[model samples]
Target: MGKLYGQPDRRPTAHPARPLVVDSQFSTTSVNNRVLVYQVPVNKKRPLLTISGIMSADFLPNVDPQQVMIGPAYAHPEAWVYLPLVNPSNLPRKMIVDLDHNRCDTLDAFLLRGQQRELVHLGTLFRRMPLVQRAIPVRAFALPFELAPHDSAGLLLRSRRSTGIHELTIALSTEKQFTIKRDEEESIRLVALSSAFFFMFTVFSLGLIFKHRLLIYFGLYVFPIGLGQLNYNYFFDAFPFPAWLGLNANSIGLFIIFATNCLFHTFGVAYIKSLNVYGRWHRYAVLFLVGANLIPMGLLLFPLTRTTNAMVTNASLILTTLNIGWLFYISMLGFRVKREKYLLITATLVFVPILYRTYVLDSPALSYSYFQPFYYLLLFGYLIVSLFRRELISQQMTEEKIRLVQGKLEMLRKSEIEQIGRNLHDQLGNTLASALGYLNLKEPRIQVARDMILDAINETRVISHNLVKDDNRPLDEKLEDLAERFNDFSTISFAYSDYTEKRINQLPLLKQQGIYLIVQEVLNNVVKHSQAKEVTIQAFLSEDVVRVSIEDDGIGYTPNQPTSGIGMANMYKRAELARLKLSIDGSVSGTSVTIETPLGG
Candidate 1:
């Protein structure tokens, strides 16, 4: 008993089982070969319609007469299979072998005909084995030949020695019901359509809640699904290339399948999170899934860890499928939660068909399967659900913010009252105290008291005026009055404009006050420090914006030098409160300050 005898109980799987051409031991014993002859069972006057099964064989002392076993026992990735289709008809007939699996890492097949076991050259059928070697686009592989009556041809499958489920399907149909793939052209067209479909999906995903990790993962899922399944069938048919190139094309497509599956599971976790789905073990489960999915990619992508055949990589798919299936199960867990329910439904709709396609069906008879469109539909559904969930969360957050702002506003009001109290005590208390000291009975002292008391009165008026200004007064009128006071007091003549009278009145009182203070601060600086001969203050309005500018022809102070006055800093605080922009630029000749305010506020 050898690799072929690794089968359980030696009961053949299904009636038309694939037989081992050679039987021998694999590990401990090798170099033994035995042949199993078969009489082609004529079906309804036609020869065998299909012959298919799994074959397990070893690499040591490789002897030919390739034997194929019938059972699930030898379904190991490292094990290889041998498929020989014998023709028992009196006349030549076309034989077709439709392989179910992407037969990998195999050499060209051979023809062993008659008792002499005459070896004949295999026709061009398996010549491009290298180029078309990949299991990517799970192709509809059919080995067709015109076998002379009583002729038998076989395929030698030396699958890559790796760990994972590895098997093949061999379908043979005699002349009567046999026909070339009817949808071959359409299938190729479908393969070509992948680019267009992928592009559209990418654009759509970008347009919708792109910031959301869910959309990002969905995009990740879609890209590989489209790129990997792009078998070289259409491209090569239209513009034939070298055999090696074809083989690479297949390999790349195959790589895409596993990679896409891994990424797809990540997208599932993102979906769960977006729906706010949670369980004690949910994150742990998802993290575990992510780790498992990445195993294959880590091994294959990292050059140092990769093997030539990468048969172990097949386990990646098994783990990936299990992870994906687990994700589906998790989605079901969310069924009771309303929001999560929709996400789950959409996920189910998306993944169920995928599971079906992977586990049950063959490569479609159509131009690619309709699975992509279904995937797109599901991806889009998830996108919409994600966006809706995000918006709902945003609304909740906004309400929370409003409550916080109300509390902050109340605190601001209390601070403002405290500020007014300090201003009154600091400014008025000192002047009143000084006036009280001058109050004496003597005539000279009485005169001093009269002067001091008058001074105190003036100080009281100034403090009151500053603390309480009628903000409703038009901004331009206030500026006009400012110009009058400055021009009368300062040595420098003042030039002013009032173009903002209409626009400035439309703004909020707080904003108008802020603008007014900025202008006042700028002018006061000019009077105290600048030795200017002339000054210009302008209030200009344009649409929604009002600009106040004050310029001095005085010796400008250096910006790098700090001033002891809080007047400028006070002006900045006011501008910040009102959301206005204040700028001050100075040179050797003078200083210019501009306060720009928006009327819409």
Candidate 2:
């Protein structure tokens, strides 16, 4: 008998139990027991393949067959299965048999319940053969056959031909593919944008700490938390770290976030408590939250024992929840206080969505990507508002100080005017009256007496006129007049220099009077107290300020020694009123009083 082989044209048939078959022709030959394998391609484009057992040798009647097999079997566009045959004898034998195929798609259909039933296709195939034929397209086919002993062959035949026949089976399933929807992608994009915005805002907010130091210390703590939250979400996926390291980073980051939140909360609580908005209980609550949140961070660093992962998560949740509740409470309190309403409203609006996203929605996309940035922005806004308010308060304080100084100066001016009036009436007026009475008394040198009396009267008149004059005259003119008047004494030599006419004229009348008084007092002290031989008054002006120096060549008196008069005290008081600075530098050689006043004054 020729080699028992079928042509390559064996069309594939769709049979649920046996979807593919290549039956061998009967051959009685003394050929060595050889097994032939067939390569069949299973179609994946159709349905999944369900494969089962091989036909037994006993299933063929009056045939001395070895064993039957199929494969280099390949299942397609999805998977592949291999079928093999074994021979007991060295001689090859082939048996005639009819290859049965059946469409058994409903094999497990009865077993499915409820929703599983929907997996079945709605339509039926017109031709079963086309399904299988389309499934396996390869041409080359072979089957393994083996010779068996008569007893074994007869047993296999009986088993195969029995009423209860067994068959190989396999189940196949198609996987459903899913794609991201537009809204999902949009959400992701929004999250990314929000995260980036907050990250930048956090950086700017942190910068404010340096720009506005003491006032923005709160921002220093707050910005770091914002950054931590941003980094935790945005960088986690992209960070090139090991799993444990990533988790550690995340834990540390979250620790910072909670820590900052606690810091801000505690600060807020303390600040509000200071305003008497909340009771001591509110402060205690803040302290408790702060302590709880800090425990993990402290443990993470050193000395303290490290917190367990579970404890950290639990503590963070508790702290966050309490903080959110407290924030709402404080906001309500703020509304009642009627002050800081804007801050309260802004913080509430900014943080509520974040809290909801965090605890309620549990959306990372919302928390890190969107809410964090918005939070930072709101924090920055708060800082700006705080700074502006602080500046306004500072300005008001400065104005109040200025007003107080002005009132004191006005009082001093009134007192000085009264004292000057008293001195002119008691000293100069009385001296002139005595000189007039002496002139009226007749004497042998009545002419000489009349001349002396006339001189004294003129002197008194000059003093009266000088006192009444604007005294707004240039410093040089004033100093010249003073020097000439002092020169009349003959014993005193007065000299002056380095005077700017325009600068002296530009000085405020009160400030000029201050300088003039300081000069006059120094001269009087030198002439009377120091018994000075010569006196020199010098004035100089620079772009920003003026300097007046009055030097008397006299025996210098030690500073702090109680003077025989109130000249020094009066000078100091006048300088204070005019806001001028005075320094008396003196020694045995001379006494120099240097007075500095702002030029425009």
Candidate 3:
């Protein structure tokens, strides 16, 4: 070996003496061959660095070299390396270099070394980055280089990116192996992303449909988190982004982290705001936290320099600690409650892993967030389940309330019917008996018997009116009772639709009373004159109006025909008194009457 550029000729001290082919059992890919490694400083300025002392390792999925004990520059985003491109065989090799885009932002490689070196911007979102290269799914940047048989050249590589730590990787592989691995990984990622979004959408839609506040808050909190997951995982790098976003890997990551934190705090406050269990002071404290999170979130929008980066990093640690403490505190306050218990478990599961990644694993070679996807997935699933459980609980409580109310109403209804039956038997029955007794007299006391019969008729009418009278019960119930009474007296079938009963009941008592009376008069006419076999009644309430319709399939009467009965006249008088608009349509086959009134009327 001879030195180039007048530098010392030295072999990589850490390189393995023999090539070690890792077995498939311990590997993530089919081929896990060891590759030589080197490191260069961001500020070194020189094209290559002294690489004889760097650490090295075999290509294994679960193992990596220990962190290099180096100077401060080792943690900088601009990382450089020198790969000794060697072809020991007689045949030439077209080798592919793969970098996990999640680990870094931009990748650049130089062919040859010294004066003859040519620069290649392999992994980047800039205009210069090749469109075809952007299509690769797994690697952040895949750079290809060629070497003649039994020849070698120094390939210099740089990664201008960082994922909170100085870690970066340069994986070596044959072209065919790289393609197969990329496709397999791509399919898996698409499925995972699709499922995650689908779950998110489901929870969000439920929140809207049911109007569950906690689910709504949870949905809002998780949206940005999902986006941040994609951003940090390098999923977005597969597509081209507009330059106007002013984002590289690091800045975008910071922005997303800050935004997610802000939203989490905001939603956290909203979730607990109405819970009296947290107390007034705790609510105020949470509000303060939301305001506090906004400070860091706002600062991140400005141009980022080293000062901003350091500030943000320190802030993140402090804010994350506070967030965890808040979760624990809430769990303690509502420890007996199911929702708070879930929060406690979730916090406990996530807290330790984040601490381990942030503090214990301080290496540039290993991922700063190896367990990120797992923990975040855990959080997402747990939150959705918690919200659904809460909704189900609410529904159960509502149903219980309805059952209680219905039970009371049933008892009251039975009592009223019993009272009405006694009145009919005691009062009306006695009056009719007296009238019959008067007729039984030989001379018949004709006038006295007639007066007794009239008194009995009046008493029966009053009893019948009382049965369908409105009091504490709903207007629809009163109308339904009226229809049932009419059905008992005649052969006609009566149907009533109260689909908008809830809305109709919201109107003033006076309006409901007027509506009930008008409907009563119309039904009487259908029975007396229309000779209807079937009758249908429908009521609807809109934003500012109420409408009710009654139709009968019968031998209808002419509108202009003279009638001795006053039923039609009574309907018109009642509608006019209530300030309602009334319309009557009659044909040989049927008669329809509709009443419309403004809500205020």
Report RMSD (Å) for each prediction in the order shown.
Answer: 19.1, 27.9, 18.0
lDDT value for model 1: 0.51
Better of 1 and 3 by TM-score: 3
- lDDT of model 1 at residue 45? 20
Tens digits of per-residue lDDT, candidate 3, 147-217, equal 56666555555556533434444566666777776686666655556555666677678778877766677
lDDT against the true structure, each candidate: 0.51, 0.47, 0.59
TM-score of each: 0.43, 0.33, 0.54
Q: Which candidate is the best by TM-score?
A: 3
Tens digits of per-residue lDDT for model 1, 1-601: 1222122333332222243222111111111122222211112121111212222221222122222322221133333333455555465665444433333323223455555555553432232343354321223444455566555655433323122223333344533333434255345547445654555376447637446566566666767655543432323222344543323322443455566666766667765664465555877776776676556545444331224234434444456567657766756665554445555666566666756644543211111233355445546555555655665588679679668755654555465556546645765676567667766434336766677666556545444444545446777888777777676545668777878657777787767766776776677667657889999988788877888888888898676678755556666766776778888888998988888877667
Q: How many pairs collide in each candidate, listed in order?
A: 15, 17, 2
As for TM-score, the candidate ahead, 2 or 3, is 3
Flag regions of model 2 displaced more than 4 Å: 1-215, 236-247, 266-285, 299-307, 353-601
